[model samples]
Target chain A: SAVISQKPSRDICQRGTSLTIQCQVDSQVTMMFWYRQQPGQSLTLIATANQGSEATYESGFVIDKFPISRPNLTFSTLTVSNMSPEDSSIYLCSVEGGRGSGEQFFGPGTRLTVL
Target chain B: AQSVSQHNHHVILSEAASLELGCNYSYGGTVNLFWYVQYPGQHLQLLLKYFSGDPLVKGIKGFEAEFIKSKFSFNLRKPSVQWSDTAEYFCAVNWGGADGLTFGKGTHLIIQP
Candidate 1:
């Protein structure tokens, strides 16, 4: 089991502004995942952040809009650039130990409201 | 891309009533199934997961799920539900190699006391 924490639990931001959400895990992990959940909806995978290379984004998502940074195994940050009302959602971070760990732990999720 | 479908969007039940949530996933090949619960104002917690071995798996909070590969379904069930079980339930699926896990729309459960 891993303990994950996110900064800025809930924030209200204006349109066109960007907000970077931080995720910190207690243990080092090989893969960190970012997910987005719209108002009263299921979660959608945003990207997969590895410690070294670029993040792997889903088809509907792009790197420019949701830039991810994973400088170390225990930490990663996701920035929602040029935010809009449609971007308002709860962003979550999850971690796994890789190699058949099977279990993935999630953070409290950052609720972002765009105006 | 894999997808998950949940049959019910909202379920209302009285305390001590039986609970069952339908979950079906696309892709018949080997897959991992999981049920996650997100209580009011809380993070998503893993209720149970089925990887291999027995198709019938039990998880935390008296929750159990059956993995029926023939039907591509992993339905969650509980014998008796309490008012505390009022929360949103999400069923997720993954192939075990990738980082992305496809999630169902989620079922909003309101257990009346």
Candidate 2:
């Protein structure tokens, strides 16, 4: 298992503002992912942050709205740009346990409430 | 797109009763299944997972889940419950790709002692 931590555990932002959530892993990892859990909804994958390349986003998410930066294997960031009330959700970062383990360990999550 | 479905949105059970939470996936290829639990005011913890080999996989806290390929289901079960077992349960699936895990709408369980 890996210990993952996210910065700004909880934040309140106004509409049109942007917030960047940071994810730091105890050890180097190959895959880091960002997820969003809206109120009363399941967690949805926002993007997969690649170590030196641009993040790979899911079908419904876009880079312009959620720009991601993975400067190293142990750290990544997800920025929610031009936030709205709809962006109010818990943002979690997760790291793959290891190669072929098919397991992921998650952070405590950054709870963002946009008003 | 791969998706997961959890049958129950909320479950209320008394202590010492048998428990089963349903989970079904819509993927047609090789997949990995997992059940995660999030206690109130705590992070998500891995309850159990099924990658391959035995159909029955046991996890922490005496929780277990059986993977049935034909039915495309991996249901979590515990023979007896405890008050500490009250938590939100999420079912997730991964198909070995660049994509991340897809989760279900989670089941909120309340265990009455």
Candidate 3:
């Protein structure tokens, strides 16, 4: 199992501002994913952050709104740009427990509230 | 579009009470099923998973789930729950090794002391 840590466990930001959430893994991983959870909702996949490559985003999500950077295998960052009240959600990062392993391990998540 | 469904929104039970959370998926192909738990103010953790194995699987913290392929369901169960078991549970499904998963709305379990 991999231990993942995220920064800014909770933050309140003003609208139109941007907040970057960082995810660090104790071990190298092939793929890291970003997700969002609105209040009282399930987790939604935002994008797949690949090391040294552009992130693959899911439907209804784009890089311009939520840009991602993965400079290495053990580190990745997701930025929620031009925030709004709708962007007020818990952003989480996750990685597969291992290569070819289906189980996933997730970060504690950054709870961002846009005011 | 492929999706997952969790029927219960919130559940309340006394300590040592039995628990079951229903999950269903809407994909018509081979799939992998998982149950994850999120403790208050914590990250999501895997409770159990089902992937081309015996229908019944056991997991940490005395949690278990049975996969019913015919019904497209993988329901989570714990014979007895503790106050510490109070958390939000999410059901997820991944199709054919896609490396991507779809999640259910999640069920909040409140185990009263």
DockQ of each: 0.69, 0.71, 0.71
- Report the C-alpha displacement of residue B12, candidate 2, in angstroms: 0.2
TM-score of 2: 0.98
| Per-residue accuracy of model 2 over A1-115 as CA lDDT, tens digit each | 8999999999999999999999999999989999999999998989988799999999999999999999999999999999999999999999987656557899999999999
**Correct interface contacts retained, every candidate:** 0.60, 0.69, 0.62
Off by over 4 Å in 2: none
Rank candidates, lDDT, best first: 2, 1, 3
Q: Write the per-residue lDDT of candidate 1 for residues B1-113, one digit (tens) a residue.
A: 67999999999999999999999998988888899999998889999988899999999999999999999999999999999999999999887555778899999999999
Candidate models: Cα lDDT each: 0.93, 0.93, 0.91
Q: How do the residues B18-110 of candidate 2 rate in per-residue lDDT, one tens digit apiece?
A: 999999999878988899999999999899988889999999999999999999999999999999999999999988643588899999999
lDDT tens digits by residue: candidate 3, B1-113 = 89999999899999999999999999878888899998987778998988877999998999999999999999999999999999999999878777667899999999999
User: What digit string (tens of lDDT, one per residue) describes model 1 on residues A1-115?
Assistant: 7899999899999999999999999998989999999998899999999899999999899999999999999999999999999999999999974565345789999999999
User: On DockQ, who's better, 1 or 3?
Assistant: 3
Kindly report the root-mean-square deviation of model 3 from the true structure over all alpha carbons.
1.2
- Which portions of model 1 show Cα errors greater than 4 Å? none
